[model samples]
Target: MIRNKYVLYFFRIIVGGVFIWAGVLKIIDPLGFAQSIANYRLFPAWMAFFLALVIPWIELICGVLLILGLFPRTSALVLSLFLFAFIVLIWISILRGLDIDCGCFGSFSRRVDYTLILVDGILFGMSTILFLSSVRKKV
Candidate 1:
């Protein structure tokens, strides 16, 4: 049990770090991020612009909170939800044969594909585990 806890914490830190870095990068280049979001052609221009502003902040805050072990359950829940959304969006992009950068990590992003889906899946799994563990601990 103790070993499992340590492993969970490690996963939390890694996942948190990735999100924080990715979010901060996107925040620094909101316009670029907005362009990336628009590439999916899933939202109106204004909606994509607004999301570009807000979503990165959400990711940054939740990610930092997760790393600091503050509001772990809430943070994990938010992160998991974001990951699930990303998974769906990425899948759609793949099905549509849109070969574009995921814009997940700002300028450092890669082309969206099954591999990106796998990465998001791992992050989602980690976030889910953290959320469940935090909830269990609270109870």
Candidate 2:
């Protein structure tokens, strides 16, 4: 865990910004995002459509709350869970020999790969750390 407040703030800003950008991109092209989700082939088409409709809003809200230091704990938890799921999904995609965009940045999404996992892993760590630090503050 990082003890420096500045370091934590940096993490917060970076993670929050990335999510906000990703959310906006997806919101701009939900159909495209839906297609990206479908590319995973793990979920039904209807589910992909539904997730495309809702997930970006969640990401946008959480990202804003995180950056504004409002509901930071909740925001961090949500983002951490999202990152965890993303990492798992990417790994599954790899094992299944599915090469497709990660749907992380909407049209700008990169292909699911080990590097994506590493990036998400780092963000997950930062989000988790923020969650823990917030918990500590409340104790």
Candidate 3:
């Protein structure tokens, strides 16, 4: 991971912007997001609904925090973990022969595919860099 402050800031902006956009979309239509989550068939309906309520808020907050450079490491860590989980889930859905949207960008989601994995992986990498850079600053 690159530890350069400038590069980290770039990543912060990119990743934060992505999450902010995603969160805003989901926030606009909670039921739609819930339905999207349920499409994955991984969670019970109630759980999906509840998660739709909470996940977008978390994404928005963390994205804002990352952009503002406030609690950046924690924010990056949270986003990174989310990215990892998303990657795994995407892979699982693909392997299981389920053609579904990722439910990542609310109404704008694309079909589950290798490209989704690449995008999530790239975001994961960026989040990791931002997190490690923050850690290096503290130490």
* TM of each candidate vs. truth: 0.96, 0.98, 0.97
lDDT (C-alpha, whole model) for all candidates: 0.93, 0.96, 0.93
List model 3 lDDT by residue over 24-129, tens digit each.
Answer: 9999999999998898898999999999999999999999999999998899999999999999999999999998888899889899999999999999999998
Clashes per model (N, Cα, C within 3 A): 0, 0, 0
Candidate 3 segments whose C-alpha is farther than 4 A from its true place: none
What is candidate 1's CA lDDT for residue 7?
Answer: 86
Instruction: Give lDDT tens digits, candidate 1, residues 1-139.
Output: 2228888899789889989999999999999999999999999999999999999999999999999999999999999999999999999999999989999989999999998999999999999999988888876
Sliding window of 10 residues with minimal summed lDDT for model 3: 1-10
Q: Tens digits of per-residue lDDT for model 2 on 35-129? A: 99999999999999999999999999999999999999999999999999999999999999998999999878899999999999999999999
lDDT of 3: 0.93
Give model 2's TM-score versus the native structure.
Answer: 0.98
Q: Model 3 misses residue 22 by how many Å? A: 0.4
User: What number of backbone clashes does candidate 1 have, counting pairs of residues 3 or more apart or in separate chains?
Assistant: 0
Error of 1 at 137 (Å): 0.7
Instruction: Identify the superior model by lDDT, candidate 1 or candidate 3.
Output: 3
Native-to-model Cα distance after best TM-score fit, residue 4 in candidate 3, in Å: 1.9
